[model samples]
Target: MKVLNKGLKFAPTKKIDKFGVFVDLQKFKRSLCLKKYFLKDPVTRQVLGENDGWRHTELKKKSHFYPKHLISKEITTFETMVLDEMEKIQPMRSQNLTKEEKEALKELAEDTTITIKPADKGGGIVILNREDYDEESLRILNDRDVYQRIPYNPTEEIKKKFDKYIQKGENNEFLNEKETDYLTVKYPKIPVFYHLPKVHKNLNKPPGRPIVSGIDSISSKVAEYLDHLLQPIVRKIPSYLKDTGDIIRSLNTITWEENFLLVTCDVRSLYTNIPHNRGCEAIKTMLLEDGEIKKEQIDYIVEGIALIL
Candidate 1:
């Protein structure tokens, strides 16, 4: 009983088309008729009126429909039966896959000449020659200005420094015992480096957009805490726009003058090019100007930012 979005269409794979068990149309139609009858019956209406179900608390919510208890129970029972039947058919469906399609899929998975990845900006998959993908990724990674070859992994070194910082903060009463414990990283790994090709920029020779994922790095907890502290202040900034939607809303309010000029700017590799010292100083300035953040908290935040940078 898979419900697809309106206007959305998809062709089933050969294996799926042959083996998939869809809902019985007659049963589905009968269920719909039952639901319609249930809604229109006078007895059901009287029950709803007596219970004041129209003004029920759940009605105000937008996420899910809250049907009348009797209707809901009946629907649940019907669905359960359908699901049970589906489970019985599942084993049979797996055994009935077309051998040709199955073999093709297996061969495709094992192929070494090509790589498949989601497009950097668009909402579709992109297939590229495996050699080309590797070459492009390495070319970007080898850029001396953006990345450098390290002699050894710095995971333990970074973890030690992070733990020492937390211990020092706790000793100085800047952070409570619980806060220090929360910030401590039991297991930290070095950030993983990857890149997604910007296919929209150039399909034949797409530039790789470098990504350094630090989710499991030593500074992850500290970074998360710092972001939590800074979010409120960030939202209050006059020029802060959360996303394209925010920019659109802001643009709608502007009373354009004849002399006013609309200008746009794009910084190439903005994140990698940012000077650590200048970035930290900017953050410090913002933290200092913010009246809500205490001086001690600001100092801790600045130190954390410096460590992360």
Candidate 2:
């Protein structure tokens, strides 16, 4: 069975209002005749009272439902599974391998390596590779055949916009302490670091994804404000094929021609590498073209989105 939030409306409660929690419809579920509603923690085998279910803990927030204690237990279980699977698949030591076995392994191995270490706080593993991966990654980033890289500066632009907003006393509530610090103390400086890409080993061959992380200069409040401003307008645009189901459906509708060429393209570091100025400009252009939003509002949005980039 598939549960989807495809058509759900955003209605946040007063308690937790920053990034609005998803609206859980227990009232609607009460209308259904077949079920007796209750909250149960499967891991702990604990059943809660009627008033203690969704009301006490926001149902949409998974962390609220499954707290640190439960998450730690689950992480340990998953870690054990990973270690067990690795042992089962790769029982023989690399030194014990015969010449032919080593040759076979070489044929199966990809041009990548990963080392796993236990995380300091959580019972999780930190997986990363040596500097050898950097050369290959850089090549991919610069390769025109793979991706046309576009660059933009957000640090200066964001600070300028924030300063303007502060001077004007507009959207002052949206600017949090961190964003203020970034604008004032950390002017024209944005720190960026790539998260380690996950690697799923297929016997010996392993392929890794390119690493990317979002802008971390501003506060979550500022990000949420921008999201709220842009989301409704952005939602009007036609969406691309999102998943396997969409792809299959699209394929079914296609008329396969005999002589036509089929070309596939994957944008490298798509989100992170998008030209920041171009994106903000595009959003402003679209909103202006729509003519529904006022010029002042569009200006505010564009200014807010500079930080978002």
Taking all chains together, the TM-score of candidate 1 against the true structure is: 0.68
Residues 6-72, candidate 2: write the lDDT tens digits. 3533333224322221122222223221222123323343332133221011111112222323334
Q: Which 10 residues in a row give candidate 2 its minimum summed lDDT? A: 53-62
Question: For model 1, which pairs clash?
Answer: none
Q: Which numbered prediction scores highest in lDDT against the true structure? A: 1
| Candidate number with greatest TM-score | 1
List all candidate RMSDs to the true structure: 12.5, 16.9
Q: On a 0 to 1 TM-score scale, where does candidate 2 land against the true structure?
A: 0.38
Candidates' C-alpha lDDT: 0.68, 0.47
- In model 2, the runs with Cα more than 4 Å from the true position are 1-114, 117-192, 195-219, 253-262, 269-274
Task: Give lDDT: candidate 2, residue 203.
Answer: 16
User: What's the CA RMSD of model 1 in angstroms?
Assistant: 12.5
Local accuracy of candidate 1 as per-residue lDDT tens digits, 243-262: 99999999999999999999
Summing lDDT over every window of 10 consecutive residues in candidate 1, give the lowest-scoring window. Answer: 52-61
For candidate 2, give the lDDT of residue 67.
32
